[model samples]
Target: MLRSDAAGNALGAGRLKRMIRYTSLAVALVVAGCATKDDVDDLALDETPAEVMFNEALALRAAGDVEDAANKFSELDRVYPYSEFARKSLINIAYLNFKMGNHSEAIAAAERFTTLYPGNEDSAYALFIIGESYFRQIPDVGRDQAVTGKALQAMREVIQRYPDSEYTKQARQRVRATEDQLAGKEMEVGRYYLTRRNYLASINRFKVVVTNYQTTRHVEEALYRLTESYYALGVVNEAQTAAAVLGHNFPQSEWYQDAYSLLQKGGLEPQESKGSWLSRAFGNMKLL
Candidate 1:
């Protein structure tokens, strides 16, 4: 009976050891399968050359694995900082991050590239990317326009520094759009103050649109609003001058007709006041 009992104990110990071994094997396999692409890239970093890593990143990007591709490109840059591939990788990283909707990251990468290789042929592209990053973040005209301002500044730099670049054309177009957006914001605020019967405050806002954003579509309406605001403030001469500027700039505009009607209702005519700034600016030109 003692021998049989010992044999039973040995068999049970063997089974327990086999179960532990199988569980460990299964855990290892699961870990291997769960290893992320970044983890794999990390593991290969020491073994892979920068060119190979860059190519891998490109392949991954083309395959629509943008996050992993960005990781691979970043790894290449980190591990081979002075390699030619490193510079190329930074540019790709910027563009890929932009495509991935990581605007801040895109801007950072592009800035880094431009700082490190300002004279490189692709530096214009990096600058363009920075401008585009800010441009894409511009909110509606009714919202704050700080980002629109930034976008305009960046785009202006692109145009001035790289006038011959292909990006310059697009930058010019974006500048116009950004300017219009800023003018729209000013118009929105002016109209809001007008609705609240704040004539002085509203006039200041509309004047910003007229003076700074004259090329924008908001200028016509700004001139009309200025006429209305000046009239409301009992400044009939300034109101008439504002209406005169509106008519001279945009005679066919509905805003001009409205301004003319408003001035006539106030027993004033739409004629330039010699003492007014609008008249000083537009008086030498023939009135339309």
Candidate 2:
């Protein structure tokens, strides 16, 4: 009976030790949690309010500290994403980046603003910034025209979607400018192929200008080149059709004279074929 009592006492002591260990661990966790919460509170105290931060960013921009202003605007967006000041800061960030010639960054910020607030009045401004950024990045005609295409698309969106907005006029101008650039690119490639006697490839490129970019200055040359290419390819009827269309549209243009002269070399005069693709493309348009 004495041995049994001793065993019981030893087991109770073992259980008591486990309980003390568990209590100590619980207390440690509680203290750690309090410390973490205090750290968070301290960090919150360091953060500026959204309105104050945005104003500071504007001040920085007014003082010609554009880079610093952009950083401040971004910080406001990160810290107070749902605040009204944050929304304003987003559009301002796009404008500031554009002023600094960070065109791609400007486009990204503008696109984000449009995606988040599609119906907002500022959305027009944001889309205008996107189009302007792409316009600023447009390369020369000899370079790839992918950026020019993007500019045209973006600007056209601003014009079509927000016709009454202040940006619409500029957007229309940019649209025309981008169209000219794209047409110039097509003409450059067509000229290259034509110089190499790749008549079919050249004709395809010229046809793009004639069909899709008729308003561009390059269309006169495009039509003349089309006449040259078809005649070289032994498609004399199409050549006559091309030259007839060119002469009809741009009678005083040097390109029309050149087209007429070229056709005369092959004993053909400019005569329209009613079934020509050129006729279908320009027949209904007021090209004159």
Candidate 3:
């Protein structure tokens, strides 16, 4: 996580995160196959010459000579198909392809690794990284989330198949972040409908987020929107209920504060009968 090599000039936290993520991937490729030769007596490669060439190509990648490094790796794989170095080299192929923005090629290379070495724990890492390659390229929400959907599916596969893997832990974190991003996109669409006085349509969209993505960071915001939407539709009981839930879950949240004011203005009078409809809806609270 150190920012610089020598002068200790620390980049921002975001830059540090990206550096760790990308470098750990590079390290995983090299480390994964270090002992691969132990399992094979004579891997079909021409050994001495192949090691020299592979080292040179690895160094090229380290120097950031990406295109040339890829060509070298390809040539090495061709000359020595089943060697330990070649197996490890495939991971680099995927990484370099992703770095060069060939997302499909990156995914294909990663798929080859997982297919050939499904039992290898490192394969899970490849799967998660493949998901990340596409996740980073997701289009604006208005355009499409096809790639985002695909990435989520792939990461979910990693988490399901390798529950204990560090990659699975990271994938879970990424999944939560991506889900929140998608939820925010949904909220944006809903807000558009609300702005146009299409309260019912907006309510439906926000409700979907609340029901399906309740774990996301957008849940509180969506609940507040629901409060407004219900009030707009003259559903004062539902509005008060939504506001009370928001308040209970997030006492200090500004969204809850706004929603509370909306509830009172809509005549749900938080101090109505202790067992009023909204009170029953919120459950176990003394609003008197």
Candidate 4:
């Protein structure tokens, strides 16, 4: 009886040990399987061909998934750096970054494309993209206009290097817009100085508009401000010359009318002053 009882106890202990071992093995296998699945999910992109990855990025962009599309394009370029698809991917990434309002990234990618493929037909487009990125970041005239200046420089590069490109027309338009923005910035500063009763500083700002950005929309206002500043400084001849230039260039402008009225209230008339900077400029143009 005692021997049978001992034999039953040993048999039960062996069965328990075997069960624990099997359970541990099963748990370990499950954990390993999950870990492998996680790795596979992480590396799923590794198996895709460059063309396939590029196409996927394009589809994502078309579907308005800009962030994902940019990531995929970057991934494609990284995975196949020497492929033609990689080169194309870089350009698409630039455009996508621009669309995503990532102006700095767009500029970097566009610049990179231009650097790598200087002779590519799309280099003009890349340069245009850089200009557009900077142009879009241009702040209000009340703020700094450093980005506007950069946009002008980039757009000028496009027009100068690729005159016949389709991008040149758009770049030229952007250049004009950037110039207007810069002129507007100058006008803002000039008006501030004028309001502060600093006629000399005001004249300097307004003169920049007239001399450097004469073709901008702000020219009429700048000329009117110049007239106001010179009059405030008690320089009647310069005031009259400024008013004359304003009237000559923008005869139908409200600014011209305002200048004329202000000069009339001072019992003075608009006339070109010989030997003045304005006279030299307008005289050369035969407009005075």
Which candidate has the highest TM-score of all? 2
- What's the candidate order when arranged by decreasing lDDT? 2, 4, 1, 3
- Evaluated against the true structure, the overall lDDT of model 4 is 0.88
TM-score against truth, every candidate: 0.79, 0.82, 0.67, 0.75
Question: How do these models rank on TM-score, best leading?
Answer: 2, 1, 4, 3
- CA lDDT of each prediction against the hidden true structure: 0.87, 0.88, 0.77, 0.88
Q: How many backbone clashes does candidate 1 have?
A: 0
Q: List model 4 lDDT by residue over 1-288, tens digit each.
A: 356878989878856754665456556767787545554444333447788999999999999999999999998987677789999999998999998899999999999999999999999999999999999888888888889999999999999999999999999899889989898889988899899999999999999989889889999999899899999889999899999988887899999999999999989889888868988766642344
Looking at model 4, the pairs that clash are none
- lDDT string for model 2 (195-221, tens) is 999999999999999998999999999
Residue-by-residue lDDT tens digits, candidate 1, 15-103:
67546654565566558797555544334334376778888999999999999999989988876777899999999999999998999
Point out the higher-scoring one by TM-score: 1 or 2.
Answer: 2
> The CA-based lDDT of model 1 is what?
0.87
Model 2 regions lying over 4 Å from their true place = 1-46, 285-288
Q: What are the per-model numbers of colliding residue pairs?
A: 0, 0, 0, 0
- The total number of steric clashes, by the backbone 3 Å criterion, in model 3 comes to 0
Candidate 4 residues lying further than 4 Å off, grouped into runs, are 1-52, 55-65, 283-288
